[model samples]
Target: MTDHRYVCSSCGKTHEGLPTDWGFKLPDEVFDLSYLDKYRRTRSNTDLCSLDESRFFIRGLLSIPFTHREGEFAWGVWAEVSKATHDFYLENYSNEMAQGTKASGVLANTIPGFPEITGQALDIAFQNSKSRPFFSFPRSAEHELAADQRDGIGHNRHHQFLELCGHFDESEA
Candidate 1:
């Protein structure tokens, strides 16, 4: 991969590499709670979270291809799943045989520039134990993100995402 460098617009510090991946630290629902309520109602690790003994969430990659690049960019986002689905994932998390397991979920993070996607239906596909699950919009969905996933995005859009994530200033481009 090519290493790109920039001064962060948000932090004003030099950062190396073109950031190809961005992630949400927590699901929006859990994050919106008051400090005490958040601690009392949510249990979370880096990969999984449960809120109020009911809502279950899993972190996964929502990948978007680069129209002219060799690989893809990804957002490490969260998805809300049914208790049964979350339990199944926990059960098979360490098993390679769980590859190809599928479940349905709702997007739990509001993606930058795609705020409408937060509650959209998603199709989650489990890969091998070495990888996080992959989240995708339904093929028939009309959201712009679905279209981006299907058609890929150009460099301009990719740069826009970087700016949106506070990685760099567009004026510096």
Candidate 2:
């Protein structure tokens, strides 16, 4: 069996186990077959996978896939939210979409139902530009404001994005 160990921060306790009851819904013929074949060989033995492969999986989410650049290139904004928030957003997303109106300027931060999705923005990324995309390590980095991250109205859209997601506090973003 795999020998990976995890420690809980709350109880200061350690435990050994594999992630259980995990399910991901993805499209058929999505993943790279070669990568899947290699992973299958070690599936029962370990949790190890190449970072480049992991980045490949993440970049697949991009609307426009450009392979001209090397390394990980994340495009667009994203946030990690709680399961409750995710479900709520999914259920009411259509309503929000229907209610959403076009902003006066190019990039408007406010969307009718975006806050519901972002309310529990446990982490966020400020990848507002195709160039200079944010590369998140194991966890989210500090909320340092960047040019593309800032909207036209003096508010950081990334910060606004966090607020819409539901964190009313400025520091939270």
Instruction: Give TM-scores for every candidate, taking all chains together and pairing residue i with residue i.
Output: 0.88, 0.22
lDDT of candidate 2 over 1-173, digit per residue (tens): 43644443335676653211111122112223466664553221111112222211111111211232322212233232334433333344345342322111011111223323211212222232232122222223122222222212222443343344343342224
> What's the alpha carbon RMSD for model 1?
3.9
Give the range where candidate 1 is weakest over 10 consecutive residues by summed lDDT: 1-10
Q: Which ten residues in a row are the worst by lDDT in model 2? A: 101-110
- TM-score of predicted structure 1: 0.88
User: What lDDT does the true structure give each of the candidates?
Assistant: 0.88, 0.27
Pairs in clash, predicted candidate 2: 115-164, 118-165, 119-165, 119-166
RMSD of 2: 19.4
Model 1, 5-35: lDDT tens per residue? 8664447787786767788889999988999
What's the C-alpha lDDT at position 125 in model 1? 97
The numbered model that scores best in TM-score is: 1
Candidate 1: the clashing residue pairs are: none
